[model samples]
Target chain A: MQGKTGSESWQEVWDKSVNGPRALIDCWQEIPCDPCQEACAQGSIVLSSGICAPPALHAETCNGCGKCVAICPGMAIFLVDRSIGSGLARVTVPYEMRDEIRLGGEAWAVDGEGNYLAEGRITRVSGAGRPGRTMLLTIEVPEEWALKVRGVRGRRKLLEEPEEVEAIEAVEDFAFCRCEEIDYSRLREIITQGEFRSLPALRRFSRAGLGYCQGRFCQSILRSQFLADCPEEDREVESFRVRAPVRPVKLSRLGGEDG
Target chain B: MAFNNFRILQHPVLGEKKNGKEVRIFLDGLPIHAVEGEPIAAALYAAGVRITRLSPHKKEPRGAFCMIGRCTECCMIVDGEPNVRTCRTMVRDGMRVETPRGWME
Candidate 1:
């Protein structure tokens, strides 16, 4: 949780006020994705730290087009126009939830962590793209809650807590690969029993990263596990071997011309 | 809306749900209304239909992880074909899909 949200310095970015609608990017995590930079046509959002870095918003130049709002795969970027009215502002938030709230529909405005702050009305819902990949729900809220509201929850969502996964007793039951249901105990036992030091070897024998995601998620965990097992000057962790048709493809597609 | 309906029928950004050329796909022999261009995984997700695949080793449940067709998690039997990535494959009118229960191995 330490590196989850922004630091104290980021408060300056969040509090940075503008005359019109400004793009607010809440993503502080160092994720290896940056579609938001390309999202802005006015060159408002800049990723000075290459592709993987958090965006640097040039709030002044932003036209509040809400293009970034729709294009952001993270659903993090939003537009806030403070110059709308006296003690009233319009905030554009990317909404992809279950409930159906229409334009001018009443919804509970929620904070960054989804706690309800106040009731707000959807002012402008922009379905901007050819078929917008993401829907931006613009809410007209009190000026005080303009910066506070990040999203809205329907009365149903407001009442429903996300389904929680209950805790089980054993660490052995901890599944390293949710796709394959390969547990830690099985992996550890296999590696220790066979003295398997290689990742590809362990993958073949234990079938940890062979499931869905094709080692995208579990390979890292297995690599870390291998690292934990060793007292070494250096550690060599070779990944799974690449093959033709690397992606999961149907056999029927292989027979087709365009496929 | 059904209590279990997770579909984004109307949203602020996307407006009233207009998925190109409305169609229906069969999932586990049940009719699921879907759009033509969108992948079956997305349609399933909107319908709150998770658990597309199950782990062959232990018979445990699995669902779509990466929406972009790279992962093997969302593989399902589509139109009598086995081991198809539902996340990548678009839903066709009357397309049939079912979880490959025992064949996960």
Candidate 2:
């Protein structure tokens, strides 16, 4: 049979087409990952270049195959059919929790940060992986929230009750630079000094990210505070940590000698 | 302890599926063996290397979490650098290692 013709709708592609799916994958991270590229059987998704590039769809050409949604490593992609007319969007997303959620269960829809914003109903559920690990959960979310709700919390933590965002201790006491052994107090002192009013100056002086792990640990926290100190460089400073062999091992391991 | 008593003798999920070369590496001056290709955190966890880095504040203990790089709980100093995520990085042979303490500069 010939592949999906250009005349078919996205729903027809969802029902019968095997080439591409109408999915919106929200890549909240710029991390190095590319499972989605390998997942597409129809060549519907094109991320053939770098792993960090967003997966793009040829709107007139895609046939709605759901492979990309199931294989995304970050669980950041989703299939949506917003043209269904009731202001209801049928969303197909990856679920990684081991909870016992029933069909039609009401899920507290959340953003990437797990913050609850709206509610959604489970429409369809199927195990999405080879080992039957992750679930490809299809939910009926309000069209307004279709772009907002990236995930759902199946297992509610006890500490998730609504609490005001206040830190009992000043942010300074919280250590952002574990390598520099710079606690919030020391960081505060460094910030208080007229010579160092921002994170770059602090990073330069204390060598905050110059440790072994290459700032994979405290860079985000430091960046947050750094942006707070100097908002002018916020966008540039939010750049991600350049990934290396971020893990630590002994020199003997890389020696290539049979150990 | 007998070899079978190890927690990673073969984990039900991650352990048995790991098919890599077994190699030895040193941690904080002690020789420890780890499976090649797996992240340094799994090897360290198998070898019981807790305290990847000391807290810059009150000096509390921290280890691996969000085994992926999303959570920064597993950062340590390897060789002469700092802030390494032990989970994302694959173990190579003979890499210098260290637990990041504070202010290397």
Candidate 3:
């Protein structure tokens, strides 16, 4: 299984930050959502390539603000501060469930995929009444596990130790960019050779987003897919260069009257 | 988790939503109830009519992915005009919508 897209930088920023708390967004897939970009008050998160692209978190600009946490419809944003103690980091996650949350109690920490990792010490809970209706829970966990732990579960569910298994590897041949006949497996194959770093190069190599829709349908998948495959640092968020005639038009319409 | 005829009645953030004015739209000569002011694609979805068009290359069913007008997957023959973006066009009373068998058609 491949690591999530655009997580390399999240890990980089997360591991080096001696500074106070900062927001770290776990959004990888390109769902048709972009509320997090509009929720940031510090202008740290931006969906540079419109709503189709995942929100890019500028970790340095973020002031550990929780504004983007509750605003996310996907519940993928998190705020972590390793500066709390010598070995403890405080991670705040957005909870939309109505389940009872006991403050100062221990809750089972889970990864992004809901697999129990370790028990997290609940420090505080707030946002009882907020505009977005999302409650934020501050859990203190080992500093090393802060970046991987995304959420905490209540004590109602028995602590069933998850069996060891490999993360599911997507093997379906479904193609999002049907116009170009590019599929996920094909994109992963291209990303592994270490050549697809730029947007135009990826497009030229794969021809996935250059179809009639011009990435209106496949840009999100392509962007997140690239980030997920190549977790290299310093990779700038990329989008396809604008090709005019945004909508499709017949060649006859572009040509001068039949001469 | 709540859905009525595939229409979201209330959302956590969007709150309660009441359909604007109900309008009549014909899809392939069949009467379909639709919400006025909403996109034609939305109305089609509410009516449980997906597969707006068959892709030109593979003849695969292509429906609305991005609700916005950017993606033309939901393009259909609307009011005698071909290749109309149903997601961008607002539903109008007595509108005729046709889902072409193939994009080339």
Candidate 4:
């Protein structure tokens, strides 16, 4: 229809489907994506203005068809139908892997922070469409985990279990202080203790702020933790410490040809 | 007989780039100028400086392996700093460097 937004098309989908429950398009990222809208047969999933706009689901009329869940390129959408009883929500999501994982298999659920939650059952598994690239799996999880549980696990599977795949995300490992071998935990502990109030004091007590990496990793963590623990303390530490000769060198480079 | 190919320069995704810098520095008081900004080990190889450091427990001659800094074979004392990661850290101008003999000073 003329001047119709995705909300309008999704409203039509709600009318067509039975018990159309509204599902929040949980993909919070600001990126261009709209496959879910096209995937819906009933026109329930809508991203009409632009791909960057968040997808909206007509909860009351959404038939739990699981089309939007499977077709989301960013995998940001989840079909949450909580009306299934005992706070148990049914979640339909996409699975990409060469391994033939079956339905009703026990899957571990975890949150965004890598915290382990309740394990759920794989209620349904189906590979649809040409080439069968995406496997749509229905999972029955507690209402709490419905928001968090993203993927499952498989043994030596080429397609890493969704949860595992997200976990291995390439966050740069903190260049731990090598001199005294102090890490994030040690820094946290030192900050929590009132004795060493600031980064300079913590460096004095433990060689945390010092070392070749020069507090690139622990500086921010230490500063925030220190501030969080002791708000009244006015220990202002420079956010970035610039160590002289930012790069390390070898002894041989200084001396010449006389071996 | 070669068993495992443990070479620092040979990486799958990254290749050794020619670091363009010519300057002199001393390693344990020996005259050498490694390519500035290249790994201390790579520059050492280019300048024919072997025996980066002696192992802590083994006391054996160790060179750079696993240039990604997982292996501590290339750890050495540089400008009075011990256990310096030569592989990961780049070379600088007029840097005073030394091969670490053991764990202690």
Q: Which candidate comes out best when scored by lDDT?
A: 3
lDDT of 1 by residue, A1-259 (tens): 0111234323433454446777777778878777877867887777766688777776656677888788787888777777766788788898776666778789888898878888889888765432445668888888777767888778763456678898978654667766677777787777667766578888888877876567866777788886776545147667777776766655667888454
What TM-score does chain A of each model score against the native chain A?
A: 0.58, 0.50, 0.56, 0.47
Model 4 lDDT per residue over A140-161, tens place: 7787666565665443324446
DockQ of each: 0.32, 0.13, 0.33, 0.05
In candidate 3, position B23 carries an lDDT of 83
Q: What is the DockQ of candidate 3?
A: 0.33
Model 2 chain B: worst 10 consecutive residues (lDDT sum)? B1-10
TM-score of each model's chain B: 0.84, 0.78, 0.85, 0.74
Is 2 or 3 the stronger prediction by DockQ?
A: 3
TM-score of 1: 0.56
Best by TM-score: 1
- Please report, in order, the local distance difference test score of every candidate based on alpha carbons: 0.74, 0.63, 0.76, 0.61
Model 3, range B1-105, lDDT digits (tens) per residue?
112488877554455676688888888888888877989898888877778988776778888977877777788899988878898899999999998776467
What is the number of backbone collisions in each predicted candidate, taken in the order shown? 3, 33, 2, 25
**Comparison by DockQ, 1 against 2, better one:** 1
Query: Where in model 2 is the C-alpha error above 4 Å?
Result: A1-21, A28-31, A128-132, A154-259, B1-105
Candidate 3 local lDDT, A34-59, one digit each (tens): 77767777777777666887767777
Query: Which CAPRI quality tier does the interface of model 4 achieve?
Result: incorrect
Candidate 1: tens digits of C-alpha lDDT, residues B29-96: 99888777989999898788888976776777788887887667788988887778888889999999
